[model samples]
Target: MTVADLVVDCLEAEGVEYVFGLPGEELEDLLFALEDSSVTFVPTRHEQGAAFMANVHGRLTGEAGVCLATLGPGATNLITGVADAQLDKAPLVAITGQGGRERLHKESHQRLDVVHAFEPLVKWNAQLSDPAATTETVRKAFKVAEHEKPGATHVEVPEDVAGEAVDGEPLADHGPVARPAPDDEALASAVETLEGAERPLVLAGNGAVRTNAASALRSFVDATGMPVVATYMGKGAISDRDERSLMTLDSGPESAAGGAVERADCVLAIGYDIAEHDPSGWNPGGEKTVVHVDAEPAEVYADYTPEVELLADPTAALDRLADSIDSQWDAWCVDAHETVYEHATRTPDPGDTVSVSNTLPILREAMADSDVLVSDVGSHKLAIAREFPTYEPGRCVISNGLASMGIAVPGGLAADLALEDDVVVATGDGGFLMNAAELETATRLGCSFTVVVYRDGEYGVVAEHQEQHRGESVGVRFDNPDLVAFAESFGVDATRAESLDEFGDAVDATESDELSLIEVVLSDPPDRRA
Candidate 1:
């Protein structure tokens, strides 16, 4: 059998159901092998979109999502999404096809050092130099990508090597092993600090949601009666509607949730990662006692030092901490809960402008509680993290680590396929156009999702920032095409909603199993401080 066949076998053994990429001549052999395998290959409009699809698939599944590309430009185009996955702690395996081995000593067409190019962005990467090592190499890539603090990995297969016959079997799938337990001394120290504190808080990060420990996290927070705040990517770690939740801490000390952080004497940082919310902004003084709980050790940062680093499974660590607490902070919890509730529940003044504060709750009501929502990087993403309530972890997908602008469309496509849930994407006009071509990819694949384009006819986030800092806007405005016609060109059902009533009507009319787009013409720009 060909090396490509064995590679496909390894992916099947890992339980991968799909591969996403655009085709190139270098990948011809692998493509043919995929056709015979059970894993479905999704051909995307662009390599960037394919990488994004793989990224969201990984984020939702906690397994390595696979994306393929040819050498040179194909490999380079996959960098952004792969880097996004890396920084966001999503498990992604990126495979690139290289030139023939014969050209190794000399410059050849479409040949570049792909392994080196990917090294800085991946957890681990290697060139598949020998056909004999195919299965083990593929196995190692998946294992590393799916390990604790999951991130992207890469495998480069040269054209000649892929075509060569190789006799090998996929490594045995032993299933995942149990995570290490927290040290007794560390756990005891954390509980002592937490118990001694007058006001304690929980800072949830992407790691909390990624590990599927939200329920355990909630139990800890509820049992201790502590306020909880999540980073932008960490939204939905506990349901936003939960009394202990303090909305999202996206703007650091300036956010409504930030008030809790300021008042917190001791912080239980559960599944926290510095990439999502750097400690320098909120913890400028570095004085608050912190208990770090996660699947991996804490990343070293000058301003962020944990008093006790509980390196263990987040769920188990939280479970232990909950049982060890001798007292509950009921008064602190009530005050903290009210502070966020006031910010979250405030109504916009009666006006023509459709506020995100109002729109997102309505949108949430229209979709199933289990349905997924993907947010593109823009002013809306900041608002969505605060306003949109996510009932479960992984239900709200945001690229906070890299905060890439065009992830929503392709990410929603992957979310639909990965979670088998109705997906809704929110994007500004500029962000929407960045990968809007992927609408055709979703249509071709029979994947259905709704796109809500916040049409302001400019780079809304940049413009808002410009206006805030300079007291005026420039160099960011652009005219948008007729969005309805643009979406309809891909055979998607499209409409325009001029008001909140009209927006709700349009959303309600859209079917879950059909491709649809609703262009919501914004009456005003988003708040910069929010």
Candidate 2:
């Protein structure tokens, strides 16, 4: 067997179903091996799109989504998406093809230090110089990528090494590393803090969903009656319909959910990664006592020093804490959530164009509770993060870590493939155009999902920031072609919706077996700062 064959075998053993990437000369051998295996190779329009596909696939399935690229630019294109996975705590395995070892030692065409370049973007990375070590290397990549606090991992195979003869089988699957429970003293301290605080709150993050701690979290909330405020990526950790759920916390300190954070004397942050939403934004005063619970210890920050650190599996910690806690506080933050809901569902003024606020409720009504909504980074992302109501864990996926634009199109495709659920991609015009070519990729693969583009002809987020600071927006505005036509050109069904009713009808008309795009022209950029 060739080393390339062994790599594919390892991937199959890891239960990897799809490998998203573009064809490259250096990847010839690996591509050939994938073709012969049961693993499906999805050729994307760009390496960036491929990585984003893997990013979302990992985030949704809790498995290491795989993506492949060639040397130099092909590997570099995967940076943003891989870094996004790293920061978002999504499990992903990135494979890159390298030039021959002889050529890599010196300056050569399309040759770069891919392993070195990927160091900061992944939890673990290595180049395969020894053909005999293929099984161990491939197995380690999956293990590290899917470990607790999951992120990206990289494996670079030289073109020569990939085709070299090898004799070995794939490594045995040992399953995930088992996490330990919280210690006695730490659990006792956390319970005491919760009991003493008059207005304690729960701040859930992506880790809560990733660790499958939602059920335990809900039970803890039930026992304590604590209001849970989720970070953007933390949405669906607790059902939005629950009275105890205060919805998502926005970036600014003045947000509706921020009021709860400001009022709480104790904050029980469950699986809350400081990367998601910095503690400085929510706890600017640094007066609240924090009870940190996660698989990893708390990141040291002036504003987020945890008084009680439960460094254990969030699920186990939460279950123990729920059992130990004695008092149940009233759900004091429900009123704040009411304001958030009202603001999110508010109708737009009578106009020719539709607004995100008006379109969200319609889209939510059209989608089932199990459906997934992938959001690209832009002004629309801010609105969706705060306003969109998600009922199930991993259902509302947003790129809040690297917060990279252009993730929605490819991310929606991955969500559809991984979850087999109705998917809707929410993106602004700027983000939509970044990976628009992937619409063709989606169409070719017979993907069934809807891309909703909020057309404002500008980078809405940057423009909003500029407007807020300088009183005028500059350099962020641009022109765009008819988005409906752009999407239709990709062999996808397209429509333009000018009002909420029309948008709802367009969403309803979308066929479940084909790709669809809805372009909503906005009269003004969404005021996400609110």
Candidate 3:
């Protein structure tokens, strides 16, 4: 058997049915093996798109997202996405081809130490050398990525190694892990905290969204009349319309969440990994006791010290917490819910041009009630995060922890595939240009995303820092092309908006198989993230 055959067998064993990548000469052997394999390889326009789609695939399906690229530049291009998955703790497997083993130390043009470049960020990085170790190496990479505290793993395969002949059969299938159930003491301690507290709020994050905990959390929140506040990554786990649940806002200004949590007596943090969202603005420490629980122990008590850490499955923990505590809300949670309701409708100042405060509410009105949204990273991303109030599942996508650039358009493509309709992607002008060329790919696939370009005219997030922290702009600013012209070049529809009514009309005109690009002109003091 060939090493390439074993590689395909390993992927099949892991239940990975999707592979995203751009083919190159170095991957010829593996691509040949994958030609008619069980998994369907998605040929993306760029390695950045492949990485982004891989992340989306893994996120929505709860499987490790897989992608491949050639050695050197091909592998280098996926760094933005790879680093994103690493920071967000996403389980993604990225493979890159390399020059032959004999040329390892020589400067064979495209040769570089790719493994070392990714080592600092990844949970583990390895270069597959021996044909004998192929199966075991593949198996271990998948397991480490899927196990507790999941993150990205990089595996490099030299051309010689992949093309070599191997005598043995492919490795056996790996099975589900036997995760330890919640211990009696831990469950008891969690219940005691919930039972004794007069006003408790359940804060759910990515962990709850990724598991069966959403329904379980809703059940507990409803039974106990506790208010629910989900993180950006945990959006939609709790229904937005539910009275006991706070609307989902994973990333944004921390003021509201910080204020709310400060007033609560007990905070039950389920799957609340601080990694997915920054804790810079929100302070969890206070007189209130926090009960932190997740499948990953390291993510526990990250933002604030947990009064109790229940190392158990999120769904099981919430289910047990529900059964352990009795229903009681003495108007405190109700008052806190009322406070959030008041802020949900608040908008940016009338004179505020650059603030996201005003832009968000305006965009929300333009959004189709069911339209899917994706965000690209920047200060603008943070602004949109706070501004848009998403109350449902599968409506939004972003690199919560990874914060990868060039993801907006690609993620929008994936969202279109998932929902089979036009999607709306909000990004800064700089990020849009990063992979705006992929608009052609989206057009070819007959999928579209309403490209809401926040034209701050530069990397405004970095620019914002330079102006605020350094008192001037340094490495930001660009004269971008006309959006209408760019989209027309791809045979896709486009429009530019400078006014409120124009923005709404632009969005209303978007339809299936028709790509729309709506570029919002920036203000000198754009408070886009208000």
Judging by lDDT against the true structure, name the best candidate: 2
Residue 66 accuracy (lDDT) in model 1: 96
lDDT (C-alpha) at residue 23 in model 1: 92
Error of 2 at 458 (Å): 0.6
Off by over 4 Å in 1: 250-254, 342-352, 524-530
lDDT of 3: 0.74
lDDT for 49 in candidate 1 is 93
Q: Which ten residues in a row have the lowest lDDT in candidate 1?
A: 343-352
- What are the TM-scores, per candidate, against the unseen true structure? 0.96, 0.97, 0.88
lDDT of each: 0.86, 0.88, 0.74
Error of 1 at 522 (Å): 0.9
Which residue pairs collide in model 2, if any? Answer: none
State how far residue 183 of model 3 sits from its true place (Å).
Answer: 1.2
lDDT of 3 at 81: 80
Which residues of candidate 2, in runs, are more than 4 Å off?
A: 251-254, 345-353, 525-530
Q: Judging by TM-score, tell me the better candidate of 1 and 2.
A: 2
TM-score preference between candidates 1 and 3, better one? 1
Ranking by lDDT: 2, 1, 3
Q: Who is ahead in lDDT, 1 or 2?
A: 2
Encode model 1's per-residue lDDT on 1-530: one tens digit a residue.
Answer: 99999999999989999999989999999999999999999999889998999999999999899999999999999999999999999999999999998996688897899999999999999999999999889989999998888999999999999999989889986876678887899999998999999988889899899988899998987788888888877888887777778867742224656777788898888888898888987688678899899887788887788899899999999999889998998656555556666555554344536855567756877878789999999878878887676778888899989888899999999998987788999998888998999999999988889999998777777787788788877777778899999999999999998888888789899999998999998885543332
